[model samples]
Target: MNSPEQVPQDDDAEVVEPARPRRKGIYALPNAVTLAALFAGFYAIVMAMNGRFEHAAVAVFCAMVLDSLDGRVARMTNTQSAFGEQMDSLSDMVSFGAAPALIVYEWALKGQGKWGLIPAFVYCACAALRLARFNTNIGVVDKRYFQGLPSPAAAALVTGFIWVMDDAGFKNVSTMPGMPWVAAAVALYAGLTMVTNVPFYSFKDVSFKKTVPFIVIVAIALLIALINLHVPGMLFGLFCVYGVSGYVVYFMRKAKGKPVSVIATSTDEPDERGLH
Candidate 1:
């Protein structure tokens, strides 16, 4: 019904208007990996319930691997988003938090009855709190160090302990020789570490830009290969050492009235690299 001039003007306006942005889908590549990791955590719970403890432990380990990759993958693909971060935290809570607690409890703590369940819940609750705090404080906290023990590290400690014990044929020890108390002790330690204020190295800021001796890289590579060869045993031992190392550093810091810097410090005052 419009005149030709009016019709052309309307058409031109429609053409010139910016197109609305398309809504993104949930099926992003990195998100797919994150979901896969979540599935692995769920699968671990199922396997643990079926009395397949070793398989369940292995699944948790796989989840850890996938969890580690998801972020790096997202960054590489330029798919980093608030949604991905939130989803990753939720997945981590399930994989490194609830699943590990349930797996360890069923494997060794069930025999302890109510006593065993307490520590399991403690670890799980602590992990949840840790994740929540991490999510809330992400950019505010120093990226170079974690304020508390990372959930993955806590999960590794628990899973590795189970793996080493199982491999060494100590299945019955968990029920005897005051092992329930030992399990409780381990759980307590893990939970406390999660909520503690101790600064642990994040390794997030480490980069190749820093000059390093060639021999150092070779030594690290060989050490990692050696550990991989032994697998669960060596891995368990290393995690145990890492857990204890925090306390040792804490004590040293207390003695000195200040935290010791693990990284190199320049002679110039007001070191930028040092944790303030």
Candidate 2:
């Protein structure tokens, strides 16, 4: 018999195992921003339904800002993941795709009935297609330009139209009898731009780090301030110009026997103007 002190302990039968690692949380800062953007999109839809068109349009813009930041934040923090990409895409479809389409339809297209709804659906469907193509081709395409017009840009064009008209005091513009056809045409153009093969400037290659004159910086700052002050009108005009410019650029390129590319059409470009 063994003494009590020398008694065999149960330790011989027990095996110690390494501790399991803690599971990581999904609520990272960047992802939080993405979620916020998604919320903003949902809110935009709600606001639009409430007849607060301006607020709804602004919410979509806020969503765009948050969406742009989330990716950069993730990249900066080295937290980029497949999950983030998918979430971002889903958020975009809501904010830039569905939200904008619905807002435009409710704010202006409702009066046109089927004529208006068709274009709204077309824009939304095109935006979805554009996003899907962007995801698949992001790495394969040229880093300097987009393959087609971005969905956000198209959305901006539609939303901006409303903002500008509102600002211009065109309260009954949407119901002005003949205006529905014009809205349909605009929507169709925006929708087609997303699927077109037009090459738009990605501005991805431009670097602000290059040495430049102080006056250039001042000029740029002033330009930005002006844009900030006149956001709705300027944004509307900018996108309108962007949409029309594509045709001009294409024709110019054709005349010169050079390949024409649309500006900011692809993810290959950097978000220079904060339009991304």
Candidate 3:
């Protein structure tokens, strides 16, 4: 018989190592939120197919809200999982990538013939690349800034234009004089910016759980009221500013000689080449 200090390797010796616990079933609550977002994305695609472009745009926005909530909820409840992350990424690609690309293509770019499809495809492709890069660079990229115009922001840039234009009495972008070319420009701009090296503030530093003065709540209420007063105008204006905000950040960083590129220097991860 082997002494207690002498670890026995014989098959007859009783194995004493601790048994590893089996993983429990997937956590439900946070992933439920992710599924809800996925449903919203699917709803957007269906609505777009039905030619109710306005409803589709709203659904995409709803997905954005739901998507934003899931990660936070996961963190708060200790329910984060690989499944949830993968689901969220897939949902974002549909909601923010394919959905916006198709909706805009159907609504406006379809009129531009072959040229229109080009920008829409570019937008869709860029959104995919952005999401993939985001997944691979998690915990390596700076939390305060995104490496590029986020896929959602790009979607908002594209769809916000649609929403505001549709609300502004232009039922079809092609109907407006010179609007087809303009829509094409917007699509290309939103797409290409998503893959650029410029940085956009991620707002990750803001802790939702932190307590603040009563005035902050008051400010939020005021903002909500403002949005209610002119929903399309307000939202479109906000996203328009955000669509161009990365360049503003980039130039400001250059002026101050601060780091303009978001690539983390000390990470062991391989660089994503050819992204511009």
Candidate 4:
């Protein structure tokens, strides 16, 4: 038998393993904005503790603006990531949930004992529940409406009351007759409404990239001018109306024999069967 032909292998040729894919690094810009929002919430808490209620309220509002921007920034830059989503949620819990609850409690509810603690705790709990539900039901809900009031808006309603009151020289009104009760009512309404099935307009359909009629731009400008005339009063009034608008829509829909739930009527999303 002929000697088996031995295949000559070049020892000089190095074996090359498949090139490992590069691990993605976390995006910094949006997360930095989120951190700023978190700092604002912490600052609000600190300011409230120091009796600077106006500053605290302002800080919370600042947090709200920053909170609104981070997600849009992430989307615009194509830097969306799971890490960013988680970071955003935690930041919101601070800026919109805990900060407002704590600040409002310090502002007006500190003296009511358990009665005071109840609304604050309720608001905080509702915020947590709302956020959890939002994350779970995102794909099952209508994009045009939130299943409940957004936490930032709820926080706005709560803190907006404080800001308007404080701006009107009511910083010391925590001791005023019926003031704490009023605060409690506002907090309770905001908290309870958050867990409701009422739908709040998400404004997701409003596109900054799309052109609008000139009248709309004019109306926006006019609205800004009006708001600037009395910042606290105007903003508080707007949020107050918004806080109740969900219930208004719910009732209207009910009366019209239309579905009131923001949860979409989709058979495809089986996971949403038992969800409210």
Question: TM-score, each model?
Answer: 0.83, 0.81, 0.86, 0.88
In order of TM-score, best first, we have: 4, 3, 1, 2
Residue 113 in candidate 3 has what lDDT? 79
Per-residue alpha-carbon lDDT of candidate 1 for residues 1-276, written as tens digits (9 for 90 to 100):
865574335544545578887565453888989999999999989998887777787888899899989999988877787788889999999998999899888887889778788999999999999999887766556667776888888888887877777777776555676776776788778878988877787778778579999999999999899898878888878778877776777777889798553332433432246555
Residue pairs clashing in model 4 are none
Better of 1 and 2 by lDDT: 1
Best by lDDT: 4
> Model 1: which ten-residue window has the lowest total lDDT?
262-271
Ranking by lDDT: 4, 3, 1, 2
Q: Estimate every model's Cα lDDT from 0 to 1.
A: 0.81, 0.79, 0.84, 0.88
Q: What is the per-residue lDDT of model 3 for residues 1-276, given as tens digits with 9 covering 90 to 100?
A: 765686557988776899887575588999899899989888988987788888888988898899999999999888888888888899899999999999888888787779889988999999999999999888577667788899888888888888888877787665567887777788889999988988888887788789999999999999999999988789878888888898998898789777676765646642432112
CA lDDT for candidate 2: 0.79
- Runs in model 2 with CA error above 4 Å? 1-27, 260-276
- Candidate 1: C-alpha lDDT: 0.81
Give the least accurate 10-residue stretch of model 3, judged by summed lDDT: 267-276
**Model 4 ranges off by over 4 Å:** 1-24, 267-276
What is residue 95's positional error in candidate 3, in angstroms? 0.4
